[model samples]
Structure formats: C-alpha cells, structure tokens
Target: MNHESQKTTIANTVQLGSDLSVNRLGYGAMRLTGQPGNFGRYADWTAGKQLLRRAIELGINFIDTAESYGPGYNEELIASALYPYPDDLVIATKGGVLKTAPDNIRTDGSPNSLRRSCEASLKRLKVDRIGLYQLHRPDPNVPFVESIGMLAELQREGKIRHIGLSNVTIAQIEAARQIVDISSVQNRLNLAERNGEDILDYCTQHNIAFIPYSPLGAHPLKRGAPLANAEGILTEIAARQDVKPSQIALSWMLHRAPNIILIPGTTTISHLEENIAAASITLTADDIKLLNEAQVF
Candidate 1:
C-alpha cells in the first residue's frame, strides 16, 4: 500500500436513499447551541445564523441536527436561518431523545413519543415532510421494532421522506430494516475511534449512507493538547501537506471509505471553511496506510 504516484480522490456528492443527494462533507449544528452542555439557546443567535448561512454558501447541502440539541431551539434556528432552503439542500434530524438539562438525557423509543417528536420537528423545521428523520437512540424499555415501525408509519403518511438510525449496532440496523428501509446510519468515527468499522463496512456493502458524527473525536482536543499516536500521525501528515492537523484527520476519513459522510461542526467561520476544504484533499495510499495504522485513543 505504498503507491506514491497514485492518489485517491473522494467523491463530492453521495446519494441518500434513492432520491436525495448530499455533499460528502456536511455540517453538524450541535455546536451552535449554548456551551457547557448544549442545554439552552445559543447565546449569540445572530452569529449562529450567519455561520449557518455561510455553510450553505460554501457548498454544504447536508445539515445534521437533533431535537435534543437545545431541546428544540436548534431546529428553530435552522428554520430561522434557512427556512426557504435551496432546492438541493437536505436537512437530517433525530428524535427519541429527551433533554431537560445538560446532565440529564434519556431515550424514549416508543411510538407515542416518536410520533410527537416527529410532529414537533415538522413544525419547528417548517417543512411539510422531513427530508430525513432518525431515531436518536434505542430505548431499553421499548421494543426496537416498535420504534422503527413508528417511523415506518410516519414515512407512509408522508411525514418523513427517509428513515435513519443513530448510535446503533449492525444487529439493530438489520432489525430496523425488517420494519422499514434504512437510508443511513449515524455513528461516531474518527482516527481515535475505530469501534464502528464493522458497521461502516456493512453500510458500505448495502449502499447505505454512513454519516460519521464526531469526525474530530467526541472529546474536543485543545490547542497543543496531547493525543498520543493519533495526534502524532495527523501532525506529521499535516506538516507534510502544509494543512491543519484537524483537516488531515478529516481527510483521512474521506479516503477511508466511499460511503462515509462527515458532519464536523464548528462555531467559527475559519474552522467551517477549513472543514469544507478538507473534501478537496486527495490522500496517497501511503498516507492512508499510515493513518490506518495509527493508534486509537
């Protein structure tokens, strides 16, 4: 795997389900909310709106959000910023999670809860039909089929265009498929986390979109923070490419698999631009090999 001459370029766009097509590099809106626990409305609402508009101007058509983010403010913020969305823009949101406080979050996958969540999201998003609605997480108390079946019912009723799952396993995905057609799977994946590799492979084989949240890792790494082997490899590659270490980390994922769709979130304009620019990076086989062998945190 040392092809220095041959370079692999990531595709610009990927198809979601059958009809919807989104950019391989998408924007995640979780960071736009209040800090500490993402518990309340964004302190700088105006700035947040501007950042979102800039995202679309930068060719990011896929925006990922969840009802749990701000509990309901995130969806409203999106609608406020880009309600009359572009024809090609795709908004994917999640349900089944309830958050009253930052420290207190729980999952409820029952049909009644899902139905209410879907309807509320429809209202907040100001859309007749949601582009994509995902189960935020599976509840231990509720049967998995019942939760997926509820989404299926909503799909049939024209409330949700496509169904997806988040924080799920391969067994859960296979189970959900029996109840409805799963269009995507959202999981945590980065250079430091490879636990979701098998699930990513499964989605790739099935031609299902695999959305990787936390593409920069779940725990934020501050400037000059120590990250052991993963950071060393990323820094070395970044130095060689004359790019940011974060960009190198993201580019590695784009080269890892074809089906992977990234939703890296940032609050600043510069970071947003850097993230979108990562899609243009073409990694060599050697670069990929080194990144693949890097230790996971």
Candidate 2:
C-alpha cells in the first residue's frame, strides 16, 4: 500500500454549502460528552479537551456536534477548549432535538422550539453566527416545511450561515429545498448500514454534501465475536492493506463517493489518529467488489 500513490486517487476536501471548504475526513464530537447516553459532561474533561485539540492539530477543521449532544454541554465544552478558534475552522452543530435524559430524547422542530435551540447553541458555542446549523430530526407532530422555514428565516437573519438536514429521505430533502437551500444531508451509513445509498446518490447528483455519522458499525461487536461474513472480508482486506478493519470500512466509503464527509467520533487520541489515517487508505478494486457484495453483520 503505497500511500503516496494512493493519495492522488482520493479527494481530501469537500465543499460544505457554497462557501466552506472542509476536509472530507472530519471529527464527530459526540463521544466527548458523558457516556451511557452522552447525557452529561464528559467524565474526563481534561482528556476530552486534549483529544479535540489533537483533532485540529491533525488537520481536522470540520467538527460535528449538536445542541442535544450534552443537551447544551457539548457546545460549551467546544467553546471552552477552543474558544478563540482558528479562522478556517468550521464548527457545524445541530438543533431541533432535545435530550432530557440519556434515555428520554425527543424531537422539537416547531418554530419556537427551533428558535430557542438555535439561540442557545449560539450562546454555548460563543459564535455570533453558526457556520453550518442542521435540523437534527424532523418532528412528526410539526410540519416539516414549517420547521425548515424557521431555519431559513434564521439564515436570512444571519444567525445561520448554512442549513442542513439529518435523518431525511429524498422526498424530505426535496420538500426542504422548496423552503430553502439545503447544504448537506446527514444520515446513518456505513459498511453494516447501506439503507442511505439512495439518499447518498440524490445528494451526489445535486452537489450537496452527504455526511455519514456512523462510518463504522453502530453497535459494538462483543469481545472475540465470530467473523464469518462481511466482517471477515473487512478483516482480510485490512490485513492485506496493513491497516485496521475500521480504516478499511471508512476508506471504502471515501471511495464510494466524492461527496462523502465522514465524522467518525472517538475519545482516545490513538483512535482519533487512526480515523484520520483512514483517509490515506485506498482500497483495491477486488476488495471493494467483495466488501460491496458481502452482507455486514
């Protein structure tokens, strides 16, 4: 695996909306918060801050977070760690979701709810205008257009630079577009989850960024779990490439589309470096074919 040669085949930067050009391999800050449900502040605040600094040092300018991540704490943590941010850093955070407790979470896309959420996020992030503000999820009780309309209104007021949607379908994306310019669509997608392929294709055709939240599998495999299926193929390719299986998975997605922007999150510095290193991996054609065909567990 000659990284120098493979580097030419992959595009490192992706446009977030029209103005912000960020690295395709970004960092997700969800894990920086407390665990069990990511409810409170991270137990190890010092270590979490160090990890975030390391991400930026590794050239990750695009950082993904949400007002709901700590219900307010995550954004505050970011400000505390890197308040006097670099000029090029683009901090993308989501609203429209509320977390009362780790287990008790709900969506509130109402105009009033969205306004409050956006304002609170601004205060927490210590930014006058958010670089990219996303609707975390569409509320079933509220009209989707109305929810999106509020974001459009905020954008017009210069509160939000760009508007994005999460957990949406093609129909939803089109509907949101009717209200305002949709900058990006984030969804759960990875080797184990391929349900968002159609959404990925739609975003690709329209030139909108497609941010995959879980570039790795969602659920953790138990210790010594059997690798009889796609996991085996992933492991085999990783061995051949002299990389970890997770790296192979992320590289496949980067190879899968030019518009993909990955936000694979981690708390440890080692895993953070590993995720960034995944960008340098370029999978072989045969490896891509087998992994594409095999069903991941």
Candidate 3:
C-alpha cells in the first residue's frame, strides 16, 4: 500500500554515462548475501533471490552488487532472479577486492586479476556487457592508473558499458578520467559519515552519479562525544516528523544532493520498503539545516 501511495519516491533520475539511466534511489544487493562482514554464503538463498525479484516489482531498476559479495554467489543469485533481464534494469557491479573476513577486505588490482574478475562477473550476471562496472577499491600494491587502464581496456573491448570507481579520492577520479570516462563513484556516505563530502561535490560538479553505499551509516559512530550530542538533535527532529530516526537519517541523504544515488542494503522486506519510501519524504529547509548541523564529524 505504501509503495503504491508513495508518489514522490525518487521522482527524478540522473543519467549515467552514454546510455544507462536509473532512478536516484536504488537498491544495494550486498546484504542479500548475508551479514555485514558478508564474506560467506547466504543463509537463505531462496529468500535472497525473491527479495531481488520483489525489488524490481517495486520499480527499482538499478541494483548495485559486487563480485566480492558472495565473491560470486550474489551475481549468480541475480541471474536466477532476473536472468532474461529487463530492458531498463541497470545491474551495476564492482570488482578488484576479495572478502576474507567481516573485518578484512583485500584488493587485487592487477590487470590479470581485474580481467579475470570482470569475465567471471559477466558470466555469473549472465550479461554480455555489464551496465555499470566499478573498480571496488584502489590497490596500494598496484599502480592506480594501471587499474584504471584495465577498465579502459575492458570498455574498448565492449565488456563494460559504463565505468565507475569506488572508495576513491578526487585526485584518483581525475587520474581515472584520463584513462576512461568515469560515469559514477561509489563511496561511504550517510547522514552520520560526512568524510566523503569533497568527493561527492566533485562528482556532482562533473555530472557523475555518486552512488552512496552505507547510506544509513555505521553504528557506534566513531565521533564519540560529538555524535552523542547530535543524536539528541536528530531524535528531536524525528519525533516531530512522526517517523523512525533511521527514516529521517536516510531522508537527509536523499535531499542532500540530487547526484547522490542511494543503495541502502537490507535483507528484510520491511526495511527494503522503508528505504524505498525515503525518497518520498521531503525534508524541509529547516530540517536540512538541522541534519547538517547534527553531522559533527
């Protein structure tokens, strides 16, 4: 009922690269694989598949996933859920990292590794070319330019449609542009974490999509004392809105930037619906000012 009535859910969309266009509020497939560390097989694979299918039925066309998620299973799960592929669906995926543990994330940005990952992802996703392929992380062991070169090569070969970068800096993005046309950038952004502000600003100015993962942000926020003070301010606002604190938290991101494409992941259906509905909640100017002040970091 809410899905049908939430008329303002991401009413606008931003273009990505040459062809792909997606609703601003998209779904992240990371949580479908399992818990946060997300290093293993999904406990309930069927439910995961169903959730992906359901998301599409709800009008979410852009689904963000990564090869590291399930390291492979997540992509396969997607193929199973929506294999023939809808014409408008943009299934974006990332590579260049392997999840060994919940806390451990390793990168292999070698040309060979990058190529192999892209090929593997293409097969599992059941697509000749990925709509959006992003470099997951910059490997300190490998030259960043070389990694971007590999993506450029993939683009020329027609394996990747649009190129994106994740967990990158402004200099890195500028460096990547020399090698390929960067369409989007995925970074950790949310109401609680404001460190990616500069990168986001650059993306917006360039007309590139800023796909923000962890849009609700992490728990036990690192900003100890300052965050504690801000929560009181945030809670007060939420009480006035008659919505959950988390909803107000996500709504802030939706209103924060037009270029920000949110991918807040969750396996629960209720949470999925809640996230989709965030684009419908319009935060007033005063509300935006309040949330901005709450981000003490």
Q: Pick the candidate with the highest lDDT.
A: 1
Runs in model 3 deviating more than 4 A are: 1-11, 101-103, 219-231, 295-297
Residue 79 alpha-carbon offset, candidate 3, angstroms: 1.3
Candidate 2 — which pairs collide? Answer: none
Instruction: Between candidates 1 and 2, name the one with more favorable lDDT.
Output: 1
TM-score of each: 0.95, 0.94, 0.90
Kindly list the per-residue Cα lDDT of model 2 for residues 67-111, writing each as its tens digit.
988778889888988889989899999999899988788999999
Residue lDDT tens for model 3, 139-159: 999999999999999999999
Score each candidate by Cα lDDT: 0.88, 0.86, 0.82
Query: What is the RMSD, in Å, between candidate 1 and the native fold over all Cα?
Result: 2.3
RMSD of each: 2.3, 3.1, 5.0
Residue 126 in model 1: shift from native, Å? 0.3
Two-way TM-score contest, 2 vs 3, winner: 2
Query: How would you encode candidate 1's per-residue C-alpha lDDT over 136-208 as one tens digit per residue?
Result: 9999999999999999999999999999999999999999998788999999887778889999999999989
Q: Which residues of candidate 2, in runs, are more than 4 Å off?
A: 1-8, 220-230
Name every residue pair that clashes in candidate 1: none
**Cα distance off (Å), candidate 3, residue 142:** 1.1
